[model samples]
Target: MVKDLKGVLAALDAQEPGSLLGLRETQWVDAKSGPYQLADHKAVEELTKDVAAFANGGGGVIVIGIATRPDHDEEVLAHIVGVDPAAVNVDQIRKLIRQRITPAPRGVRIGWSGADGERVLFIDVPAQAVDTLFVVPAPVGKPGSPRTDTVAVPMRDGDSTYWLPRSEIQQLLSAGVRALGMPTAQALIELVRHAVSEAGPGDGPRVGQGLPDREREMRVAYEQLAEAGLGQPAGEAWAQGSAALQDLHHERDGEPGWVLCLVVGCPPVVVAVPVWQAIVEAGRHAPGQSPLAAIGLPRPPAGTDTPWVIAADSRSVDVDGGSWGAGRMTCSGRGVWRWQPLPRFSLHQGRSAEIGTSGQTPALRLRAVVNLPWAEAGRLEISKPRRTLLEQQLPHSAVAGAVTMLSMRRGADLPAARWERGPFGNSARSVGYSCTIAGSHGGPALKASVRLALPTTMESTVVACADVLIEDAETWAAALGPGWETQLGFDEVQAVLLAAWETAAELLPDVVGDVAGLSWAAPPTTELRMTCEQPADNGVLPVLDEFVDLAPLGSNDGGPRSRMAVTIIAAPAMGRAERKSLLREALVRMAREFGYVDAEVDVV
Candidate 1:
């Protein structure tokens, strides 16, 4: 479960001092009953003992990076910073433990953990029925002590605690055998033989005569039990229990060999339990990691970067007469600015944009004559073009105040026209046109018109114009029919249109506001005279047979729009009943938006 070094460090930091219950320092143990020291030829034997002891004692942590020093303060120093580089072959460690330890510990998780890039192995030993004891050949110390005279056994009592001495160990082993149904000597012999066969040709000894044979049997049994899903193998379980027992024995005797041991049995078990218990504990613990715990949260991967544009300035114009006229108002100041795109367009309305700015800047207003088809919508006839100049340095707050005031005064009335600053730092402007009309449908037909207000000093400029048409609910329903129930509705249609607009904005480099100089041209002016005649094929319809005279504005020379006349005819399909039905539905919606009620639609 400890996935990385972060987890290991967190685990260590969370532990209470001296709470490493079932671990023992190999080098610190007394010679008689201890496993091999770090410098000894039988060092593997020491590792095997602690591993088994921890397993037998009810599971514990073993950290190999730090060692206890014999200083006056009884200080613990991080000595062997990590596993020796020469010992990179973990197979050797595995072999030593597998060959020397009894009922070899099951589910033993081992790996490196340290900032120094040194190896620090960990063994998670599970508790068993009785204590597991480790037997190692005793080393004779100087003078009177004879080298290799007798075997010494070391056992773990509690975390960092160990116990030794033949008599006490024999007593513990006897008790364990008695409690767990003692195996006969013949059973041991048979087990050793089985181990030899299973270990294959390179393995040594077929009897109790070799450590490999005994270890082989223990490992086999442990594997079998683990495979059966019975709380690890008996070997590890017994080792854990034995470790705890050894700790208790060491505490009473004050023996030197049994210095590293751990005790756990009461409530609030030490160490993070397995997944099942952890789940239960999680419910009991408060949200977030405790000061003593380490935790991690998952996060989504990073996404791709997206490009965006912001509007800087804006202006609006309203023409008041049917003739050509020009008016300007000085507006200037400074302010923070942000931009947003325009909303909903039916003509593949590409990206729309809006900008907000605040500062001591100048604001300009223009008046213009707008053409409409309905006689009820009268054209403005101005007596004279009037220009008003207002000079005032407005604060940043005034801009926001102006926006609020404008919004309030509108009172749900959709804006008829608005302006925006150019994309670049240029004296460019933009205009928006909107109109609303009553329809037979539940909602009103909303239409948007647009024009780019560019500086007209430059000629031959290409400007990209975008327009959006918002269809009424009735129009959409009529167009989509019942399929609207299964497909995306009006809202989805709007979203798709907005997406297309954004795509177009990205694709088209020469956007209207992007460049400067030339202004967007309006429809050219013209004077016309014409003659009409009845169509021979369709008696009810009339067509323009010829033009009497035509003239273009700005020049007397004949232009593309001058002296043009053409006849029109309805297609046979358009005269069909089904086609007429579709046409009526479409025309009804279009006519409603154009403010034409009960008006005849003549197609020629």
Candidate 2:
């Protein structure tokens, strides 16, 4: 709970060290064991990164000189070890914060935490506008070039910050969702436009030249003292007008870009875990050459439970394909893929073709979808009462009947989205939708696709309603599995709540303590309806009142139970290793409950 200066001080006063032990680093606050080394470029980059992440993630605090220890899956505050103030240079740190972060997150504060001269330094960042993403220097780019050294956009996820996957940047810019999430080419063009006027006659290209004209006509030498960001124009490589394309073609969703990328420092996003596993399991069609291995990712020994996350940058070297091959020739970006999670298991030639050029690696960025099923929120029509009911628990940002808030469409053709009415290709009795951002982090956002299966019987409602809620929980759990912890004002545990009541329920006080960062004295009120459908006027509208069961939502009330009557959308939360050792214990405990013998749960 040591997320603020008050908490830090309390810990210092009560215990010399470890008073705040075992406290996880929340989204709004993080602790560093020592002062930043200004002389090291990497250290300076990291310093700017920490500041940017806080600002990007709705602002928070970074406490330096606070020692921490890894406890379970999280790093907890372990000591009050202080840094020598004499060895710290507050002014330089402040300068880097300003110089490195684009637009320098508004209202940031830097100073000692307590007293006139305290042992710890606090870098406080205010929530930045999401309208524009912040950018920093990427490790690889055109060498010795100023302003053209390939800048990366850093985004904060939970308590950790990652380079905004290049694929996402394209989607945001294409959707015109934010200001700075531009395509690499457009980003470069924008940068050029922003700085060209200030350059001297011979310093760089003129404003009058078109991009192609500039690329074909200029040549300049590297400036050893050049800086990559603000106050500098495009570098010598760009000036020489070499044919390095901007490569940022903004697209909706994500693109299965031209080249196969290998992600560094992060795992590929799982668009649909089940679908992913199907493809992985399908690898048995041919042994000794797994799909993951074809992409250069390392797999654990056959029987070990270890996960094979692609966490390293293996994109720089030459790869020999087992079932695939190398074919580095084209640069037109045609075969280029932008968002295909499952690229055709084939050879990659794009990297070999660029060896002597950009020197940049195309890191793999995997992704997954987050739509929950709704019979058809966009197309279906309903009375005022039913619409209001849908609006309550599955609340959204738009006005009462907006499709974004409650998409009432037919069961089959969902989220493929035809915002306008006038389609008759297909239909289904059930439908489901998706999401990426955390719901509580920001609302009025695209949260989930609620599946409202058409036909409903007394028994099936339980499965339908529970399925959506279960997806809501599991999706969040998947989002924060390993290397994920709490974030201030964000309660990840709410996703895991199991409710028995139909109308509404208050989370038990004991459950409140399991929340992420901030604690609540009084639990919040949340409606937990086991059913979304209302019975006939003559029929008693079934409610799970203090106890008995029944369920689900939308126009249809009760019909004969068909496969169409129920739908289950689950987000795989744990890894394959989760099946180890806990199955018997779970089966033993779960079997005690009536009609629950085959319940399958993937737990760590």
Candidate 3:
């Protein structure tokens, strides 16, 4: 089972010693006589049926050109009647199988080998979570033999093929659903258990609070199934099998930071596997072209570009987080192909999302996770009046890092999840984003939380803040003299803030709004007035606005700490809490700048 190329080589080696006649026939293994020519329509149909059975059932290998040894009395062994390489057409056979199969199997392998002076074709069909019965249309006779092809559902019974009974078809479908659900449930249980075990002594009671109800149901179902001695190993197998997961484990297995996890349920809303896979693989390296361009998410226009601030500079956003680079690829198809990011969402305590179409859709569930280094990401935050400086830089930079991650290939929708203030409001220490990024074409999707918490590696929030301050000083020349002019234009600054505010509002619709109003007076002695354009329910501003005035200390003053006055304005009748929220929002927006703003807003 573990054998891939190694297994093939081992088979070839074993053939040298003696005939492979006595090879054991397991549920996952099958053998077929050599179909001399793929032009033999009947033979091709039979092969398609055999492969489909293996996929619908547990995964198995079909060794073609193998037949029972005539001289041997035992039924255990078979002789390799190697295929004629020249006569056998692999492409034609593959195309036939792909066209006939309802939903193509994932990870199917086709290979050829010569053993004992004979060539053989081997097809490795991987088990699929979607229970789709593969049907070959009729005309049991030759092509165009006065008979049209009739759809016939075939199932493998031991060493034979039979029409799957209607009752069994229902049962098989149910099994397929269980196959997908049970493993997911089990994996989640394992995740919660892992979280509990890893939590510090003081963090005892909150281990699984973030688990979603759907996940909880899955956990219960998985437990029940396990008790019945019927469970799925798919989730665990997928996690182990993914190259992306392996890389993440290697790079940041135990480090604490924000994690974006994707659970892509197949048949995607878009059934373009070839295109999807291309982009996913291409995204791992410097793609031949901008992968996002294929998916219609081109880089922003000039002057409107919201650059990823993670880069040391404000110039370009080039981050490659995905580990596996693309290999050679050549595609031939009818339509134009485009790339799309994998579906993904945030996963943390108290947040989760579920998305997909109804029960009618067939899907193979896949899960992937991306871990963002807290130390590096946290370095984007700022303290005092410069927090906006960091927030402003985070989106594009974080996106570049996140997009390139191999795990992101599993992320389905763009902007799957966006950040929102947490229960205690925004903090340099922690924040959470939520969204759903998984599903088959019209299938339901799942949601999860992406939390940016203080890194275990960092001593305190202050330490993370200091890291950014120091970096900002060097990067943006935050230590410039009093007479130095700010290089940021008012429009550019407004655009950046508006962009972030919009993102926040999108992620936290109930709490935040669009830029109702934005007006900034020039830099030195700058007067900035920001407030919600539309008033809340009672004709009063939902949140109050504030004006901050800062006077620089003399050049000889120690580190920069200017004289500051924070003027709090009450929206005619807005409450203290609303005023506070408004102030926090203002602070959150303004903290991204290294310069100062000093002015008060008096409502008209």
Tell me which of candidates 1 and 2 scores higher on lDDT: 2
Task: Report the number of the highest-TM-score candidate.
Answer: 3
Where model 2 places Cα greater than 4 Å from the true spot, the runs are 1-22, 114-118, 140-148, 177-604
> Worst lDDT window (10 residues) for model 2?
360-369
Query: Sorted on TM-score, highest at the top, how do the candidates line up?
Result: 3, 2, 1
Residue 79, candidate 2: Cα error in Å is 0.8
TM-score to native of every candidate shown: 0.28, 0.30, 0.31
| Total colliding residue pairs, candidate 3 | 55
Q: Write the per-residue lDDT of candidate 3 for residues 1-604, one digit (tens) a residue.
A: 2234234334532233123456645466666676635556776667767777777676667777777543333233366677777766765665556545544444455656554357677776755555344555543667543222355566666545576776886676567557656675675576567645533343222211233323343343334323222212111111212111100011222321111122222110111223333433333212222222222211222353221111111222211123212122223343332222221111121111111112311111111111221112222442423334334434443222332231233232333333333322456544443333333332223222223333334321111100000111122122232343323222322333233222222222111112122110100011122322223357653221111112221122222322111212111112435433444444333332323333222210
Query: In every candidate, how many clashes are there?
Result: 70, 60, 55
Order of quality (lDDT): 2, 3, 1
| lDDT tens readout by residue for model 1, 1-604 | 3433333333443231123322233322211121124445445545666666665555554665544554443343334344454555554565455435554444344444333443344443434334344444454443332233355555565235454766887776566556546476755565556645643353332211223323444344334323222221112222222122110001122221110112222111111122212222212111123211211111111241221111113221111111111211111243211111111111111111211112211111101111111110111111111100001111121222232232233242333322232222322232322233323353533222223322223321212222223333344333333443312232222232232222222211122322222111111111111112222345532221111111111122221221111111111111234333433343333333333344333420
What does candidate 3 score on TM?
0.31
